[model samples]
Target: MEDIRIRYYSKTGNTKKIAEYIANELNLKALSIDQNDYNSPCGLLFLGGAPYANIMSSKLREYANNLIKENVKAVALFTTSNWSRRTVRALKKILREKNILVYDEFLYVHMLAVNGAIEKTKLFVKNILEKYKG
Candidate 1:
């Protein structure tokens, strides 16, 4: 598998939980946006966030905007929200604007109810791993 990095911006920890789960399965540390730097290259980047009123945080937008295509090859998005998958869509748009490939599929977890988050995340991660494992 190629080196993968997981980063997220979470206001209520719901997104964080999902990010952590993805990282744990891949044996990597889940990094908050504040902790992650874009100085290094990675094969795939898993970015997670939640939007308020369908508005993505400026910080997260900036991160997506500054993502160097040479450094981060591609992105897979995920979100945790009450009912909106807006963040995932927003991130995809931002990344694609810069010509970065955004995986067609994304993960979403209900913010208030994550009863099967791990299992769902496992399946998501499995598919991601398989795709990149080559």
Candidate 2:
């Protein structure tokens, strides 16, 4: 099996936490978009970012747009937000336009200005993992 790649950009670390969970579950390396080399070989890709003012972090958005993979079989998207707004929806639209196959997507509610409750976040991540792993 090819390795899965998990990349994320986060300011408040909520998205980073979720990305870590996904990466750990998939046995992939969790890296920040700013720190990783995007040219690495991988079978799957997971992109995550925090929703900023109802939009994805500009850095993450640009990174996703600039990804130069020719045949990505599976892609997963995740974002953290204070409310259930259109953050993930916008990300999905962007990825669709880029012709990436988004297999699953999730939006997690995070407390504003804080890293959020770790216990709650863990539960949410567990639920997501269970759902996707099935």
For lDDT, the strongest prediction is 1
- Candidate 1 yields a Cα-based lDDT of 0.86
Q: Show where candidate 1 strays beyond 4 Å.
A: none
Q: Write the per-residue lDDT of candidate 2 for residues 4-87, one digit (tens) a residue.
A: 677888886777777776665656667899964555655567777776767777877777676655645456666677775466
The sequence of per-residue lDDT tens digits that candidate 1 reaches over residues 1-134 is 44799999988788889999998898998999886487688889999899888798888988888887888877889998888998888889888987888888899898866656899999999887676665
| Cα-based lDDT at residue 120, candidate 2 | 53
Model 2 residue 14 lDDT score: 73
lDDT of each: 0.86, 0.65
Count of residue pairs whose backbone atoms collide, per candidate? 0, 0
